[model samples]
Target: NLRALFGYMWAHPGKKLLFMGGEFGQRREWAHESSLEWHALGMDQRHEGVSRWVADLNRVLREQPALHQKDFVNDGFRWVQRGDWEQSVVSFLRLGNEAAPPILVICNFTPVPRLNYRIGVPRGGYWRELLNSDAPMYGGSGLGNYGGCEATPMPYEDFSHSLSITVPPLAALFFKPE
Candidate 1:
């Protein structure tokens, strides 16, 4: 769930702020005098996984122009799926300038895995799965689209093309066209 939250924040248009201990899922409240729970990383795999996940998120944010180029612009973001309260799923596209490829961000808030979930896209081609919060490296169930998924000609939602993907339980995914 922490990964999903972080993924959403990272994908969302805005500046980001991570407190000292948040990168590793520190459970306790922050104290001015006390140091972060550094030992937790050595004690539990989850702590390390979260730390690594944050690092990857940072890397992706830096590498993908679509994520940061239009941080405060109305034209930068578009929703593909929303208002699905019962399923607790949301998906959107983040756009940059004309040169930058749009990124698809999907979040599954429920605990149940959503298999073969189709999502609409603006263009058709190979959409690389740039990030998956449910990957085993992130202390998750290792459910993903095996790197990425190709958009088919079949229309879905509001787009002319679509890609069927596996949205892991309580996970967020990022995809970019190739």
Candidate 2:
């Protein structure tokens, strides 16, 4: 759940901030007197996974212009799927300048795995899965789209292109055109 929350924050528009103990999934309350639980990373794999996931999100934020550029503007974000309350899934696209490729972010709030979930995209081509919170390294069940999914011409939502993807339970997935 921490991974998904951070993923959504990174994908959402505007600035970013992380509380002191959030990077490594600190279990205890924050205390200015005591130092961060650095030993937690070595104690559990899940803690290390959260740290690694935060690092990746930071790297992606720096490397991908679509994530940071034009974040303060309304045109930088677009909704691809936001009405699926029954499935508890929401997907959106983040846009940068004209030169940068748009990024698609999907978040599944439910604990049940959602298979064959179709999401609309602006273009039709190979959409590479840049990050999957459900991967084994992230202490998840290793359920994902196997690195990427190809967008087809079949129109499902408002867009002409769509990709059939497997959304892991209580996880978020990030993709970009390749």
Runs with alpha carbons beyond 4 Å of true place in candidate 2: none
The true-versus-predicted C-alpha distance at residue 47 of model 1, in Å, is 0.5
TM-score per model over all chains:
0.98, 0.98
What is the C-alpha lDDT profile of model 2 across 80-174, one tens digit per residue? 97579999998999999999999999999889999999889999999999999989988899999988989999987799999999999989899
| Candidate 1 Cα RMSD after full superposition onto the native fold (Å) | 0.8
C-alpha RMSD by candidate, in order: 0.8, 0.8
lDDT of 2 at 98: 99
**lDDT for residue 17 in candidate 1, whole number 0-100:** 95
Local distance difference test, per candidate? Answer: 0.94, 0.92
Clashing pairs in 1: none
Backbone steric clashes in candidate 2, count:
0
- Per-candidate clashes, comma-separated: 0, 0
